[model samples]
Target chain A: MLDTAFEALKTFDWGSDLAALAPIEEAATASHGKPEARQDLENRLIAALKGTLTRDAQDYICRKLANVGTAAAVPTLAGLLLNKGNSHMSRFALEQIPAAEADQALRDALPKVSGDLKVGVISSIGARRDSAAVPALSSLLSDSDPAVARAAILALGAIGSVESAAALQTALRAAGDRRATMIDAVLKCAESLLASNQVATASSIYKAFTDESQPRIVRLAATRGLLACASQPAVRSI
Target chain B: MSVIKKPTRRDFMKTTGAAFGVPYAITSAALGNSERPAASDRIVMGGIGIGNMGRGDQGAFLGRKDVQYVALSDVREEVRDKSKANVDRHYNNGDCKVYNDFRELLARTDIDAVHVATPDHWHAIMVIEACRNGKDVYCQKPETLTLREGPLMIAAARRYGRVVSGGSQRVLEDYRKYVAPAWAGEFGKIKSINVNVGPLPQLCNLPGETKSEAIDWDLWLGPAPWAPYNPKRCSGSFSINGASWRSFSDYSGGGMTDWGAHHFGGATFICDVRDQQPFEVNYFDDSNGKYLAYRYQNGLTIYHNKPKTDQLLIEGTPGEKLAPKPVPGYKGEGGIYGDFIECVKTREKPFRDIESAVNTAALAHLGNIAYQLKRSLKWDSVKQEFVGDAEANRMTDRARREPWQL
Candidate 1:
């Protein structure tokens, strides 16, 4: 039944009868208990992905791989990361793999892809909170494309490490047209920082924006962030 | 319920006093009036995904004198045009701005609040983005499409200090009969309640049809996997069959979440367990068929599709009476919508706050996972994951297509 599904998958496209793929779906669930069965299914799906198949076929396999794929499936998925038609779905599979290999694949692809594709990779990295990729993302802050630059800023914000917060603070000083975007990202970083109990670090980020030189709204957000920091148990302890 | 302070004519005058110097120039719409409050004092509102429910929500807010509905958004041209026409008709002007993208509507700093009635998939992204943009949200039921979204949405709302309310009017209104009795302690020491909902969402492999010019197909499928534009695939119908996006696992949790948002929402409210999630889900597959018993830490159990049990049927200690606890009701005039708007003004939690709504939605999701895995599972509510079950943990959230991350 699984072989029959794979055979039909070669021509599978949007609107195809989904009944032909029932075996693959069934295997995804039935293999949950049997690790060997799960790995075998993953291997078969990865092979089909590497074969000459329709985009729909690849999409289905990637989704299944996301559920059962291990580090073994990372390399093949990463190979498609630069393919415009396949990058998003590849990232889709990579994002949920819960393996360090998936994170490394995304970071490696960051310098290889540009524009929207790069932005997509950056987003996946941020979603994974790949602290190792923070340096690579920080370098993209000044990328020529505003979308790429903004994606980097947002990705850094999502990472929300003390280093990411510092990068955002540095970017805020000369963010030009991206200043508002940077401030929002910086505040997001501060909020996450506060959440992780780095109240003093969050307070420092907040204090930077509270100056009279900043916009009233930015000052208001900064003041609120500072107030939140002050109200923290760590700060209250002192 | 606490006494709600209605904006008196004098109060309106005091609030809109900034235009006192320009009284001669102030029109009826801009000036303080007995029937309609001044425009300056009203909650500036917008609607996203103005479909069937969106239209109803729009009308609810539009009918309110305290709300000034300024904008509308929908992926389909006809829906957007018709909704804008409705808004224009209500205000007697063609000034209601329309957009194809909801982000455009959320970007307007002047817009104080937004009502999101998009499909189940779009709810979390729109709500969180709206909150991030400093706009309060009144998002439709099943506000979360995944377990992970619940916490993120709640956090975004809290961090921004935005008044975010879940759209589940039926939880309190439709289930009032059961709710009142349960809260009144008519059934002493409530044991368990059965909520019958589902036919979990299935994969969508609908044959693609010719793309319609009337709708932005790409925008409509935003963040979801690429699929051919089939009418039934994106239909706004309530049915959870292949006829609508509600039937697809990518977009919804079928009836489990579609109507589960109301049924489970009602069941939890009746059991006074709206704020809690089951600590363990025991799946049963016997001669009778499959069902689930969700055990909560509070000693309350919720049975999902248990055999021969009626929906929202409370199994409790019989004949023994206890002191009645006050049933929480909507704060202001017009049901849940009024509750949301009133909370927006007073900064109070709404009758169906996001946390409680997420909890209800979480029940449907947890049950769906149990059914999908066909195994009993222990859930660590604080961690929001299955205990020691990596396979079950993988089912907690799905990978969204790129450029859209929570």
Candidate 2:
């Protein structure tokens, strides 16, 4: 039955009859919460990724890997990151993987991909809050393509930290008409820092906005951000 | 039980006036100096804003043979006529009165209770006015459009000493009967709660179009900033089932505040954070929608998480630790209905009263403020304002256009 299910999966059409795959699904269900049993099931999914399967079949494996994919699944998903058709679902699964290798794979994919795919990779890095991507995101802040530059700004915001805040401030010089957009991202970065209990650093970002030279909305936002920092308790857990 | 005799015209006026703290002279004048019955053995209901939820509420109230829907009101001519037809069908006659304006219905001296299901903007004023008119109110969720409205609703309910239930109905009698055990026992000392009520509201960007003639578009736009009517903006989909004035910032807070009330009202109680508030919110923009999150001083986190596959059943996934058994032919946790009827009889607060709805809705407002500002807000929940954030504080109340001003 398992053999039949795997064979059926090789050509899986989302629109096709899927009842034969019940045994495979049951096997996967039985393996849930049992990591060792789950790995065997995950291996089948991983093996399916390497076969001559339909794009739908690959997407199915990628989604399943979101819950069960591990370090071993990283290399395959990493390779898919360059395959335009598979990159999205590849990043989707990779984003959920807890391995440092997976994070490293996403960081490596950032500078190599172009257009929205590159933006997607950048976003996934920030989703993981992998602060290591800060230098990479900062370099892209001046990228000629406005969307890439905007995505970089947003990713930096998502990975909010003293370093990312400084990177954003440095990019502000290059933002020109996109200054408001940059300010929005920086405010978010400041918020993330406050949430992480780095009140002093977050307060510093807000304090700069409070300067009379800033735009009125920016000043108001900073003033409010400063008040929030002042109200924090001694500890934090976000 | 001895059947109590109904009050005469003079006694009825006195009873109604006494219930709402209105002077007898004013009460009689509002009733057009017509003879009126002060009390009735059966509940004499007049539904105001009988659009979607308003009609649903009437259906529930009608389940009791004793509920007599004497009058119906809606700004739209079609809705009022349709609702009036439903009411007439219940009585098996054309005895139900209909009106395009709610104030006309409220002025009827025979009405003992009201069901208000207006758009988000009209909720506070209608509910407050109904309370003043000495009618018990079953208002819809998101009891107020702004923080200012919540207090006014509470004041009216208290001042009038009328039974008022804000419609986060899950907290009413059936809600307590089912969810109480889960809170006290099943979900032992809940360390955290995930509301999973979906994302923050987005700005209304429904493509514009020509307005319709059947709907009173201007009346529907009551109090909201005047903008040209679009079919999407008006009676949306026309079937009361499909109408949604929610996406627009003018009328509603999208799905966040709408369903958030249902989830937040119960989550606060289950998490043992009732009457308390989460200190700050943390949001991550996921491009598709925001991953909105909040942190309470007690170390609990509440946020929206779209459920994964196989995570829901017909009665659905039990949250925190709710295990509600399916009772055949039973409407889901008929708590708000039970509370309203009981309160009307006893002249007491409904179990899920205005104050509780106000608190839960306040949380949703906070989340909206945080989302709008793209920052975490340090809320002084006691003051009901952001600590020093005027911009965030300003968002707590929208500027109502003239005539709708609070």
Candidate 3:
């Protein structure tokens, strides 16, 4: 049955009977609940990616890999990162693989990919909250492609570390395009910072935005953010 | 081919509201306050299980310019058609997406949030899936059919960082807002509360299977154990006035949890039972040998008997006390609906958040176990279990049917 499902995965396409791929779904389910079973399935999925397959079939495998894949599957997924046809699905799996190797693969691909592919990989790095990618992502803030630059700032903010914050602050002071986008990213970083109990760091970012000198809406959000931070229990010493 | 254009509940709300002089609201969908957001700022919304309360709540959401109900989903084709028409009627362009399954609605990246008004059995799965799909959730109460689902529901919301609130409709579900001064000493001291809701019903042993093209019975029973479908059992007849599934313990805690979610939520608010339970629940069997009343640690007794006025009575220690004027702002007609939409925009938690449904939901389950035991039971509110009583504890979590396992 499993072999039949894998065979179906080899030629899987949109608008087909999904139940025919039930064994794949079953394996993904089994892998989610049991660590040992997931390892076995994960290895098999990675190896399957190495063999020839249709784009949709590779996608089906990637979709399942998003749930069960680890660092061992990272290289195969990363191989698809710059492929125009497969980058989105590849990044989808890598963004969630729960391994530094997956993050590094995405960060490593950032310079190698271009256009929309570059933008998608940069966004995946943010979704992973990969702070180590901050230096690489920070450099893209001045990229010729505004979309790529926007993705970099957003990803850096999602990383939400003091270093990422500093990079964003420097970018905000200097960037000519998408100033609103930068503010949105800064606020996102502020929120992530607050969730981590970096109240002082978050408060500084909020204070910078709350300056009556800033936009009224930005000031309003910053004001609320400051109050929300104040309302919680006192921040613990770092 | 039959489409229910307007649910019977819409008319029921008007008749019931006017007769009782209560604010069971269904205003025109065009009125907007100064606080109403701009068109682009409007939250894109969808409804899952647009049946009774779901449709009612969706109507209220349609009233707000800050919300756009872009899609409707339900297991029943009739329900989908009806809800699509309802939403289409509100939007001039009359373009509203419809799906037979909720997962399809979740897959719509355009959907910013979802209203999960599925049955007690389907609530957890639908809401959890919605949360994972990055949609804020406005789910109907009781939060889960059983106790174990409480923590899992909360964990899902927290993990995904989505704002989720239960449809306890605190503003409309109970007497808390209406009788505020009662707890604030206008009534001296609330000695006991006669919560006017029926006792738990026996297992659903409805005679025959109800098969019809109007509803997909299998989908309606998602997460609930496979059962023979009866019209009285599947999707429920809106003409019947209340969900019949509430009478079956397999899907609900009967009318106790149905109305218990309302009354208990109100009682706890009035009694200040936050972070604690009754510590005791004893049902003195009625003439039919059914558990009928219970007491709490605060000497506040709650009787399961129906009230003369269809409202719970908060009895004072000495004598009759004046029920002060109902709070005006607090009892906004369909305010909970607006509250969830407001939370989605502000990224804030609703006043009566999903977590607020936990204790009252727990009360409903505990009350059922006590009724089944046909005796008084001691409760451990903190641990959320029966003290030294494994039998009662086992009743807290029911076995989930396939693909619905938490």
Candidate 4:
């Protein structure tokens, strides 16, 4: 019963039969109890990933693809990295892919994805803690949207990149009250980077946050960040 | 019946009004108003199940100058005596009465209202009888044992013109200030209502016990279908041994009907979906057998489990978290009792009024019916019956033993 359902899902062009796919999706997640049944479902999902379909269908297939968690979908998801048209689906798919494949895809996508979509993709990559995507994510700290810039700064912190610290410091200098949330993000990222032995990067982030002319809360958070980093006697000595 | 020694006036005031901040001068002023009934003119109050919950209800009425504690009754003699003493200790007028049987207490013309705090199965009969005898009722949550009995209870309340309220206090307290705004698109087309009532503890088997003199074995069983007098069933000592009599088919409809009445009642009330049954209902019992989920037509999924969470989570489109913040006063056991009394005086329907609570009870009953039949059964809320499922229909209402008809 499971094999037939999976086969039906694979061969059926979701462009024409989008409604019918829901049951198949439900059955895939439903308690099938057998490992062979799940594998059959995954194979059908992989087949669906290869097909051309509407955005909704692609989104649905992408979700199933992620759920299947196969190495095969990595290439398909990676192909969408440079393709901004379905970047959300691509980012979602990339996030679910194993770190080795996802990191490269996210790094490639970061330069190409502009605006809100770029921020989303960078955040997704950062959330996965793929250090390879750090350079791309760090570049976003200077993006147009304060939200996106904040997200990028936080992503850099998560990745703990020394190269990203200088960018965060520059972003912090220009950021006034208009980007308090973003500034907090940069301070946090710098703290994480410092903990990873990237002290020069952390010190620059700390200085930016502690600038007295900045918002009182931001300065306090920055001071707190310095204290946290300084708590390590070896780092304090420096 | 043994006459219990009563506390003095000072002790009585200390016991009852210690937490009530109203000074005697203000109380006297409030009582002096011509509109307010005198203590002697106030309605006499009696409690049937004066256990933990029952005593709490009794205490609320005890504070009201418009009510006098007249009688106390419980099958458990200890609860009855203790409750009677508690009432006397507060009133200190030596005018209170006590009875082991609730019927004798209800028959007294002095008592104007009865708070039915017995287990779920006993609610219908007690409430209906109370109404028939011209007594207003405040029955605890999940107001009926089964779906069929809810409408009958509603009919009894309406037919008798007696004010009846379900013990779900969230129904009162600025719920409209929270729910109405959400329903009016303030929350931007509610995507889903996730009601998590936490998880129930593991069921335990009953242990061997020596029957104590405090309990009445036969009377405690009451209208429930005949079973041997097990001390574990009555004393709740078997709770740790996984022998939850209430969780079983014969005793109670598990936690779904028990807690679902309170949690699901809040969800449906907030959604303003009203008495219409869901277009589709899917129930899922948790893998651990400790929880049950019921998804309704409005995309609201109610989870009835043990450790009740944020009573109801009303979710919507991005950036809109517009469900009413749960009011502090609308929580725990006493919350409902206080709300019911205020509504009774104001002549306003409470948050868990009979009409809405009946709908909640109906939903819980349908979930149980679906589980018991081991197949999904479509419900007609208007007609209040299973669509074409005759076997499922039989479970709607149980037969009352001789002379207990509604």
Candidate 5:
């Protein structure tokens, strides 16, 4: 039944009867608690992804793979990342796979894709909060493309590691037309840092925005952040 | 604790007292003499997804003296224009604005708050974005599309200090008969409660139809995967049989979340576990048939579709009596809408605050995962993951289409 569904998936396009895909859905459901079964199902799904199929069929396969795909499926998924039509869905599947290889695949796609595709990859990296992407993301903060630059800043903020926060601070000094975006990203990093209990680091980021020269709302947010940092019970000497 | 005072309408009025006296041709309402608060004092509002429930939510806010409905947005041109006209007719002006994209509506700094009645898929994105833009939110019922969205939405609200309320009037109004009794301690030391709601959403593959120019089908799909725009695919009908977006997994969790929001939300509130989530979900499929028992951290269990059990059936210690406690209800005047507006003004949590709302919605999601896997499961509420279950964790959230992330 699953094989028949895979055969039907080859021709699956928009408006096709979804009933033909039931066996695959059942296989995905039944794969739970059965690691070997999941791996077999994932392997088949990955193979189907590499096969010739309609855009819809590929999209459907990507959705299924998102649930069960592992590192083994990353290379095939990564190959689709540079294709504009398939990049979003490729990243869609990659973002949820929760594997180091998937993160590496996205980071690898960063320099390879440009425009909206680049922005999408950066976002997928942020969604995964892959700290290792901080260096690559920071380098794009001053990209000529405003959207790409803004996305990189936001992605760095989402990662919110000590290094990501430092990268944002460097970008903040010359934010140019992306000033508001930069400030929002910095505050986002501060919040994330504060949540992760890096109070001192979060406080430094917040203090930079609290000057009278900053916008009132920005100052207010910074002040709030500073107050939050102050409220954290200080660590005693061990 | 140091208190930071936000500049409010009252603060503006105190500083601009001279300008009020010099105002020319001011209407009675604008002058604050006709029982309505002055226009400056009223909360400026907008509506996103102005369809069935959106239109009703618009009417509720539009009719309020304390709310100033200034704009409406919907992907479909037909409803957007109609909603704009309704707001214009109410305010006696053409100032009402309409947008094809909700982002533009949220972009307006003047909009103090927004009511989102979009499909379940758009709720988290719109609400979080609205909060990011400094607007309070009153999102329609089933305020989440996936379990992962709940925490993100709650975090956004907290980070921005926004008053986010889940839109489910029925949770309190229709279920009050049970809630009041339970809160009043009629069911002393409640052991468990049963809630029956489901037929989870299924995958949609409706044949593509000629896309309507009036509706921006792409915008309507938003973060959902690209699909052919069939009428039934985007229909707002309540059916869960592939006839409406409610029936599709891409947009909703079928009745499991659609009506489950009301049923599960009401059950949790009645049992006083609205603030908590189940740590364990034990599934049974035997002579009694398939059902789920959700055990909360507080020892109270919520049974879902257990055979021979009526909905909202509370089982408690039979002879134990307890002291009556106060039953919480909506603040201010008009039901849930007023509660939201009042909370917006006071900076207080709304009746169905996002945390409790998310917890309530989590029940449905947990049950869905349990039923889908056809086995028992454990959930770590704090970590917000399926305990040691890789396959189940993957289902916590689906990959959103590009440019849309929490």
Candidate 6:
């Protein structure tokens, strides 16, 4: 039953019998209680998910993986996410991994991949709340892909680390046309870092943000960060 | 399909305020005795926050005849009126009250239960207050603003003996149903569950806009620390000026608190790990410019990595992975609301109960504390305090303004 489902899923063009596959797939999962049956179902599902990596396949796989909600497909999903050429499918697969493993897998896969895949990996890692990817993510601030670089900047903000503060400051300084959004990301990151008492790091970052030569928004963010981190007595004395 | 014209903000505010002001208490007697209040009486319900999630919660209860629409509440008067009209139109209860103040609606003794669809910050107070007032609560995900509030809410429910359930509903299904049997054990012991709530994607911050007259700025700012009235905070738009409440610490705990309640809460439920203090809490706060890792005592770690898209990932021993499955006919994709209703009748534990809800809240709060402290701090779940960290401990409970004592 499970093999038949996988075969159907693999050969199944989503435009046609996609609706018909639900019951067979359901039966396979419903019978997942038995050890042998469950493994067979998972194996088939994983194969089907990997087999269907085309645009339609990717969408179908994402929907199927989302419906299946099993860990057995993590490796395949992670593999897809790490595949640099298939950014779309990679992202779709990355979105399907349990949030817990998504970041770790992406972090581990970051150095191994580049370009669109790198951006997808970085964005997915940050989205999964994998703060550990901060170092890799920080480095990606210089990523050639503007989307990836922006994602790195935003991911840094989401991760909220002091380590990434300087990088954000640099990114904020180098930001030419994309000033407002980058500045906002920088300020949000700086504010978060300052609140976390990454003061020394935040202060330096603030200094860069406050530099008169920088954009107006960056300066404002730096000023806010400084004031936010300032002691009450310091504020009163000033 | 009737193409409903969107109501203007001013019109919504006036209609909602007028609807709430009327002494429109709904009596259970109006519904047939079949819907009578009993130990197992079907809970006639009304939905507050009937926008994206509000409609979903309403749909769960609306399908059952045992539950009747009593009222609907939303700050956006348009949403409130539409939701009220929707229930009345659907259930044919033309007289149901459309309320702005959820408190007023909850005040009625006839309302046995209320489904809270407000933002994350409003959840703790609303749930606690609702339970305290004898109304069973079905609150949306990320049950509380902080970990500290979770226990307080659990206590309120326990003390008041109200059926309070969190919105992480995936726990209702037997774990074995979706995945293979061997895959479960192969996944190794539950190692760590990471939840990615948002990639609301990067958007530029806009200058604060003038508060529209249609909005009850004061009411919308309830409980959150006062800030300049901005449309972003109340309008629920992605723009900072429009939805700035999400970015501010005073209003929300960012994505973790907002979506963490759903994604992370799901893992806590599946693993059955409750009230266990993370040995240590640390955050990378890559938003500042770097990605870092937060480690916990149980050998579990949480990462706040940003993803390209919104999804959840769970990693466990033997490298098992679990992601959220789309459960159709299930409330909110995870069936959390439906489970709560079922539990309300059967007196069973919902997917994410008070204890687990508090634990998930604690975890998110710990992340916030770690972000604030800028250093990893030890925690004692039993003590409910940061071990030897006074400043961090201070954050455990927030200062509620007078007249709203926790």
lDDT of each: 0.86, 0.70, 0.70, 0.60, 0.87, 0.59
> Evaluated with DockQ, which candidate comes out highest?
5
* Residue B134 lDDT in candidate 4: 61
Maximum-TM-score candidate: 5
TM-score of chain B of each: 0.93, 0.78, 0.79, 0.76, 0.94, 0.75
Candidate 3: tens digits of C-alpha lDDT, residues B1-406: 9897653312443465578777643334423447664334567889888888888878878887778779989988888888888888777657799888787999776678888888788888787667656689988877778776776576557644578988776534456553577645576667766666655744444544537767777678875644566776754532222347866766777777777788777776665553355777776755554544556776766665533424556677665555444342222234787777777766777756667677678777777777665557787765566787544554566434323333
Give lDDT: candidate 1, residue A84.
Answer: 83
* Model 4 chain B worst lDDT run, 10 consecutive residues: B198-207
Q: Which digits, one per residue and each the tens of the lDDT, describe model 6 over residues B97-176?
A: 88778778877755777888776667877886676456678887667776667766775575345677777554344333
Q: Which regions of candidate 2 fall more than 4 Å away from where they truly are?
A: A1-238, B1-39, B170-181, B205-209, B236-243, B284-290, B297-299, B306-334
Give the C-alpha lDDT of model 2: 0.70
For model 6 the local lDDT of residue A112 reads 81
What TM value does model 2 have? 0.52
Q: What clash count goes with each model?
A: 1, 1, 2, 15, 1, 54
Tens-place lDDT digits, model 5, residues B42-123: 9989999988888899999999999989888899999988888888888788989899988898987768899999999999
Per-residue lDDT over A22-82 for candidate 4, one digit per residue giving the tens place of the 0 to 100 score: 5564555452345676676666666666776545455556655554444656777777555
CA lDDT of B268 in candidate 2? 68
lDDT of 1 by residue, B277-385 (tens): 8899999999988999999888889999999999888888998877899998889888899999999888799988999999989998998888988889999998788
Q: TM per model?
A: 0.92, 0.52, 0.55, 0.51, 0.93, 0.51
Report the C-alpha lDDT of model 2 over B1-406, residue by residue, as the tens digit: 9999766434664666789988644333234322432224457788878767777888888765445678888878878788888888875778789887787988787788998888788888788768656678988887877776786677557544667888865543323543555444555444555665635544333444665556666667765644455665655322222245665556776666787777777666655565676777776676556655667887766664523312111121345444443321112225568668767776666656788778888878877766655566787765666776544554565423322322
Residue A128 error, candidate 2, Å: 44
- Stretches of candidate 5 off by over 4 Å are A33-35, A235-238, B1-29
Q: Residues A1-238, candidate 1: write the lDDT tens digits.
A: 9999988889998878889998998899889778899889998999899999888889888888877888999999999999988888898788888899999999999879987788889888887778898889888898899888888888898888999878878777788988877787888889888888888889988998899998665787788899999999878989
Query: What docking grade applies to model 3?
Result: incorrect
Chain A superposition TM-score per model: 0.96, 0.92, 0.91, 0.69, 0.96, 0.66
* Residue B71, candidate 3: C-alpha displacement in angstroms: 1.1
Q: What CAPRI grade goes to candidate 1? A: acceptable
